[model samples]
Target: MIISTRRIKQWLTFLILFVLFTLLLYQVMSFFTDMFEPDSIYKEPIGDAVKVFSDYGRQTSQATFSELVRERLLWFYEIGE
Candidate 1:
């Protein structure tokens, strides 16, 4: 069986349009779904994610953040009280 050029063109056009329509529908549905999503729709107000470090940035000998650095420094110093 032989297919006509016009018929083939029409089928090609239909296939292209069908694929495009499916993609567009998918995008629209995704947009609406995102708009209505419980978590994404209503979120807490934007705020800084990092909390300020306590102790006012003062490095103490026993400070957790400075503990390793203090230990290294102590290794070089004489064991003096």
Candidate 2:
């Protein structure tokens, strides 16, 4: 039940190379899969992966971009009713 030093070195090298090869294969496969993904990928951007920016502060009143522009325009016009 005794192993030779050369045999142990061979097994170690094999294990290391096997692990590296598996990692390489996984990366190649994932690259291909991502390349072939549907264009609708962006349609689900706010999915479970990222939900922070989509639903921001709730307690504070926030004016949208168009509303802010309109308010600025009215202020500049000085329309008093």
Candidate 3:
């Protein structure tokens, strides 16, 4: 089969369109699904940011970060026995 340059260009265009269409469909589905569940359980950015800084500080100082962090979390959640 002798494939012409025009046919090759058309095939390339179709491949590009198919890929773009698939990406757009995926984005639309994700947007709708996220809107339905707007509130996420693990969405505490402020608290998480503070925790990351605290962990970094403890690691640099060679201190028992886990013990202190556990105590702090326990106090925050009132999970004392």
Model 3 C-alpha lDDT per residue in residues 1-81, reported as the tens digit of each score:
898999999999999999999999999999999889858678777543545444345365655767777778888789563
Clashing pairs in 3: none
What ranking of all candidate models by TM-score puts the best one first? 2, 1, 3
- Report lDDT (Cα) of residue 41, candidate 1: 41
TM-score of each: 0.47, 0.48, 0.45
Model 2 agreement with the true structure over 1-81: per-residue lDDT tens digits: 897999999999999999999999999999999999987856765546745333323425577766766876797789662
Over all chains combined, what TM-score does candidate 3 have? 0.45
Better of 1 and 2 by lDDT: 2
- Badly placed stretches (over 4 Å) of model 2 are 41-81
Ten contiguous residues minimizing lDDT sum, candidate 2: 50-59
Q: Which regions in candidate 1 have their CA more than 4 angstroms from the true location?
A: 40-81
RMSD of 3: 9.5
Instruction: Encode model 1's per-residue lDDT on 1-81: one tens digit a residue.
Output: 997999999999999999999999999999998888787545555777554334535765555756755765686586652
RMSD after CA superposition, every candidate: 10.8, 14.1, 9.5
lDDT for each of the candidates? Answer: 0.76, 0.77, 0.78
Best by lDDT: 3
- How does model 2 fare in lDDT? 0.77
Global CA lDDT computed for model 3 = 0.78
Ranking by lDDT: 3, 2, 1
